[model samples]
Target: MTGRFAYGLRVHGLDRVTDLMPAPPGDDLPEVTIRQHTGPRPVPEPLDRWRQVRLLADGRHLAVDRRSGTATFHGPPLTPDLLAHPYLAAPAVVVNRWTGRETFHAGTFVRHGRAFAVLGSRTAGKSSLLAALAARDVPVLADDVAVVHDGGVFAGPRCIDLRQPVPGLALPGRTAREGSRTRVSLPPVATHVPLAGWIFLSWGPGPALARLPAADALGRLAAERSWPQLPSDPAVLLTLAALPAWELTRPREWGALEATCRLVESAAEAAAGQPA
Candidate 1:
């Protein structure tokens, strides 16, 4: 599988690696390929001070650098561990440090229906909610950090290394799994959910279910943008803004899982009706 494919990542707008980036020995670093592409890719930038993540734009910007280890495309086969470390550790600024280029960050899900994902701030119950859903027979997308593209999200072919298990949720017993920041599958599960709805959870006095206008939701979404401090791309901004969003004020208890699921499902169904 290593040399099976020709290209590495298709960052919608950057040049594919025409040549490899040299890594020195004793440098203990691996070889990297600077794939090149053509399109409107985000230019490389410094890591965000607050989140410690960076965004890079080659073609379709998307990379999450966690500062764990140097990322080299020239080294071993690509795995999900490298991807989740930087973002899950600190989701604030995802693409910047990761790809050193612009990449997409949004709530990606299954197309017709099979898998789903929940993303937001830390302690936003992403893992907990996923666990709950999994109990109900839903396969977990990439837990904290998801690799999204073409309106779909893929689960890393690796076990997500969630530092500690959630208080009450139980995970499946594993026979063999690799570790990174989040233990995940190296190849990742291809089962994907379509870009249904982007739900944002907030802790406040808001109702259990309150749908905010896209305009109003935009402000909060912007605030929680993976890389808020960095300049935003109009294309990306519009892409996210255009995505239907629902703000779930943190519920008093986790009992609202069904209600929450209903709300998201309804919204997704409605979005499907609108003209694309």
Candidate 2:
């Protein structure tokens, strides 16, 4: 199977082809090709880790070694959104990492020519805040993951997600057109976002926001992905170092989301002032 998607690439020679980016401008080939391994799978190097999906990275290509399809994804009703999107999207992250890029579980939005990225674990108020920000017509650069390369931010898949829906708050999936669930969508971003800053979301009693030292921010980023030591480590560390970052503490109060957004906005403005 084969297809194309955003982010300059294609899906080539795979059994169960799903969503793909449109070829880069002029029908360029995919950044990496995927093929099923019917023979014996390659043994992992001493440091390699293979959980549900096996990720192999080398100078030639980023490979996804798998036996299951989207059907194997255990979840609620088998909606097209759950089936088609995640299968391709998740592997792409490891692929980017293999290519010496850093990917984050971030929801990124552009405002006034600058972009703000929110990063956190599940239910850390990242998605709830995404639900709120989308209400104000902020263009989301990426969701689920954001790829950082050459001082800019590129879209992952459009995922305006939350643990549970909040009343009176609308999100991406609600107004999705036919097939939107299965297909990937990003705002018409003709160019990458000049990433202004990243906000690390954490939960606690106090909602105070604070600046993160470069070293501390770098540590948090590496810790989140459990990034293994490899030749690619320097590039990943350099990418995180180039950006300004902050830790946005979510107040335990249920009503604090709005205030947190305000704080995030301020942090973004402060980031905009820095050199990219």
Candidate 3:
């Protein structure tokens, strides 16, 4: 069980192999150990205030003890895709939150050297847009969960799981079906990249990108956080909100995807030049 890195944490005890980033040279991120429950499903301690537990409808169980940096999973054997997603994803958020970091339900893409988080609701085509960006040689830090700490974004699993395959975009990697979505593995990225700005997805009759005020951006980010019930560090959220943000709206038609990608790239380039 070699330790693997993802979302700024060194993960240990995963039985199934997943496309996780390698531990960097002289890595010093906090560690979270994973283990399997063999006996009766272990019950969470009532007095453990930092404990977070979730039992999925599919019979999978996940429990994260933030104070001890341990995560336990129980259920059927996990595929790489499953291990990389809900199993690892949920616990990552909990551990980060307890360790003075913030987690968002957003996809992250990179242009030049900085990362931009794409925020939207579940059906907002985030993964699809990431797939499009990947096809154009843009770097994707994380496709589903973006973790932030110390004004930087941590790279997550090296894959994007799309609900449906994007038409005419052939991304090279191992492709497999993961439940209702198709998982496409991608090349690994650096452990961390400087946070740049944010892009919010929306629908409209025409494609447009409009800058958002700090207050509006903060509200949207608060709403799209990973664990709303958990306590968050207000200072970190406020700092992230102060970064540049924009609302990106486009038509729903597939033909608009190309133009939308162009808009995002252009906006990122323009924003990169301004003072932070």
Top model by TM-score, which number? 3
Write down the worst ten-residue block by lDDT for model 2.
Answer: 67-76
Could you tell me how far off, in angstroms, the CA of residue 190 lies in candidate 1 after the best superposition?
2.4
lDDT of 3 by residue, 83-179 (tens): 7764678888878877878999999998878999999998998989999999999999998899998888999988888877889798854545455
Q: Which regions of candidate 3 fall more than 4 Å away from where they truly are?
A: 15-18, 42-49, 57-59, 173-179, 274-276
lDDT of 2 by residue, 158-249 (tens): 45544456546544444222333212233455336777777888888667798888888887777555234433566657666667888888
For residues 40-135, write the lDDT of model 1, one tens digit per residue: 444445555322313343223433333432222222332333332332223322433244322223333332353333457666666555544444
TM-score of 1: 0.53
Each prediction's TM-score versus the true structure = 0.53, 0.70, 0.91
Predictions ranked by TM-score, top down? 3, 2, 1
C-alpha lDDT values of all predictions: 0.41, 0.56, 0.83
Worst 10 residues of 3 by lDDT: 40-49
